[model samples]
Target: MSGRLQHKVAIVTGSGSGIGLESSLLFASEGANVVLADVNLPSAQKGADLIKDRYPTVKGIAVKCDVGKEEDVKAVVDLAVREFGRLDVMFNNAGIMHPEDDNALNTEDRIWDLTMRINVKGVWWGSKYAVLAMRQNPTDEAKGLHVGGSIINTASFVAVVGSATPQIAYTASKGAVLTMSRELAMVHAREGIRVNSLCPGPLKTPLLMDFLNTDEKKQRRLVHLPMGRFGEAIEQAKAALFLASDESSYVTGTDFMVDGGLTNAYVTSIGEPTLPPPSSLI
Candidate 1:
């Protein structure tokens, strides 16, 4: 029931806030030695501090990392191995969706490059390095002769469905994540490393809410949700927890949707209110 990840060591990128932050806490609660890596050093440290404060027995560290840079991402995985003695889970959760990432025609080359660099390239770098580390030290019980680990990449539902909202760069990058994850999963299945994507719909994370400037902007997104509500950060964290733990040992190369039924509904109905209606989604 508890300590599902006992003795596991993990690296969660973009742990400054939102889903990353929530997942880091949950991983720690489940007994994983988590490395909170973020571009913002203070934010990452704050999250790590909170976990250490609450669970003194748990081990966690904050690392300043920009997932867009391969070296920084590599450093995150290295730190985990150096500090924890082994690496078991790698959560590539850092991403960006700038205002300039509108429709293809409106989106600029700079925005496209930035989004892909962080979202796509970052995952590649993280996955590349994580595989290297996981391969060296396989702790998870093996089915064949391979010591396997878990790799959870944060993607979005937009990757599967065409979004009229048009964050072309953001959506495309996530699509890459989904396909890349599957590829890695298949390649490493023989090696014992399971790769998967965690696809979340419109969650109330700062990454999404900070961009919605008006009530109408918020409603445009809300209308698509069959549940008529945004998802909570904790909800996604629980999903990550399952994937990170051995409970999902058999699950791999799959897209785990944590959307509030947004992807399933063609004509969505407003449901019971959980989070208050946003006056200004930003």
Candidate 2:
């Protein structure tokens, strides 16, 4: 039996560790040739190697790409097309946050610049190149062809709702990403390409760990989460897979929140409001 993404080619940026890495592996396992692009070359290579090791039949390549750089973004897209014949999906997942600079006033200009460059401009560059690549293969199903593509950008729930302990720059960048997805979706809809953003809530990734290291901080975060637990990377990966695959063929120009009900629920806790269940739910 063939896989859902059999013979398709995909590029996942920031695929060194966390959601991007997991998504790359999942895409390869589902029979798509994958390009693992990251700022960290070794980490990206390791991710590619994991795919090659586990899915011997699948093809995987690692490219050192700083998504914020237009040249690097174009190169990664070009490599995907050059190696795999065509580009089917682009996951603009590279992002960064400065947890130490929680306050907007306290955050430095450099932190804001770096965050915007990677989180906001990076997504734009990825989409720009992806659009260019997808345009190369304009196919008409009426002509017995399907030559369109999908672009998935990583946003955060913080884009929609403010965080209690705010990283202003990160929030602002994601807000830009959220809007960019909508505008790009409309701009490229005529070309038969789909663009969407994935808004993941607090997940169990290294970025989260870096911020919420202490028991006190962890508890404070859990208080805002209705689920009362950090989400897994695989959970976000599954969301990415859906958006990347034909499963969400008609879904575009919207944000898919893999936020474990954190966005929808008003009340944080379910049981015993009078007494805090644990320090973990600070």
What C-alpha lDDT do the candidate models reach, one value each? 0.89, 0.88
Candidate 2 local lDDT, 1-282, one digit each (tens): 247677778999999999999999999998899999999999999998999899998889999998878899999999998987788899999998777556877899888998899899899999998998888874545533367789999999999987776688999999999999999999998887999999998988998889877888777777878878899999999899999888888999999999988888765863456765698696
- For model 1, how does the per-residue alpha-carbon lDDT over 76-150 read when each residue is reduced to its tens digit? 898898887788899999999897789979999999999999999999999999999998874444322235589
Error of 2 at 135 (Å): 0.9
- Candidate 2 regions exceeding 4 Å error are 138-145, 270-282
Worst 10 residues of 2 by lDDT: 137-146
Q: List the residue pairs that clash in candidate 2.
A: none
Residue 263 error for model 1, in Å?
Answer: 1.2
Model 2 lDDT at residue 104: 73
User: Stretches of candidate 1 above 4 Å error?
Assistant: 138-146, 271-282
TM-score of each: 0.92, 0.92
